[model samples]
Target: MRSFVRVLLGLALVFAGTSHLTFARQEFRAQVPELVPIDEDTTVLASGVAEIGLGSALVLASRRRRLVGTVVALFFVAVFPGNIAQWLNRRDGFGLDSDEKRIARLFGQPLLVAAALWSTRGGSRQRS
Candidate 1:
């Protein structure tokens, strides 16, 4: 079950990353925080690359799966501020136009973090 969820999350990340580099580039830009030092487009592109690398690690890493998961969770945590910025600044992206929708989207970040950790945890053996 964990493996299944991990793979699904990995694939989802890959797809999202691909969208960041392509069709959804503009949408992702809306999520970039104004305080980010880099240009919005560059931030999006770099994050897209990061997502791809992390997603691939989630799918492929075995001996270090827990480490990969930790990194993935950290990545999610790292991006959370951008989500908060979007909500606070009323920036629309990924169809989260309303304040309510944006607020609701914020709730999903923790779940992603939890999922990343849970899915990569060692099963019934020893916790890493």
Candidate 2:
């Protein structure tokens, strides 16, 4: 069951990461116009690639589980700034609203971070 959950979580991350990598330049720009000046497209693409790599590592071997978890956690923390940037700018870019909706969108980052941490820790536990 635990491994199943881990694989599911990994797949989810992989999908999301791939999506970001695929459309980071366009979708991200469309979602947050201000990001244009900040070179967000490149940053998001790099992050997406990092996410894919980390997600792949998570399902590789139990011996490296801790390392993979640590890297994923770090990646989550690293990308948090982009979330904050979007919130602060509050512009409709990536099909997201630029106004009040920004508040809800801002909360998503911490939730994702929490989930990533939970998945990592849960996967690292010894099975009964």
Candidate 3:
């Protein structure tokens, strides 16, 4: 079950990252935090690259799953602020135009964090 969840998460990240690089690039820009110094396109592209790298790592590096999961968890936490910024700024994107949807989303991030950690043991040294 855990492995399945981890794979699901990995695939989701890849899909999202691909969206960031392609069709949904503009929509994703709406989620970028206002205070971030980088240009919106740069933020999107950089994050897309990070997501792909992290996702690919999660999927392809089974032996490195501990490290990859930790990175994925931290990456989710890092990008969380963008979720908040979306709500606070009331910027509509990804169909989260309503404040209610955005608020609910804010609470879902920790679950992603926990899932990553629990699934991969999050940096723990594996018993060989």
TM-score for candidate 1? 0.95
Clashes of each: 0, 4, 0
Winner of 1 and 2 under TM-score: 1
- True-structure lDDT of candidate 1: 0.93
lDDT (CA) per prediction: 0.93, 0.64, 0.88
* Model 2: how far residue 35 lies from native, Å: 9.8
Return the TM-score for candidate 2, rounded to 2 decimals.
Answer: 0.72
Q: Which predicted model would earn the best lDDT?
A: 1
Model 1 lDDT per residue over 1-112, tens place: 9999899999889988999999999999988998999999999999999999899998987788899999999999999999999999999888899999999999999999
The lDDT-based order of candidates, best leading, equals 1, 3, 2
User: Which candidate has the top score in TM-score?
Assistant: 1
Candidate 1: which pairs clash?
A: none
Ranking by TM-score: 1, 3, 2
lDDT of 2 at 116: 56
> In model 2, which range of ten residues has the least summed lDDT?
119-128
Clash-forming residue pairs, model 3: none
- lDDT of candidate 3 over 9-121, digit per residue (tens): 88889999999999999999999998999899999999999988887777776677777888899999999999999999999998998999999999999999998878787
Residue 91 error, candidate 3, Å: 0.6
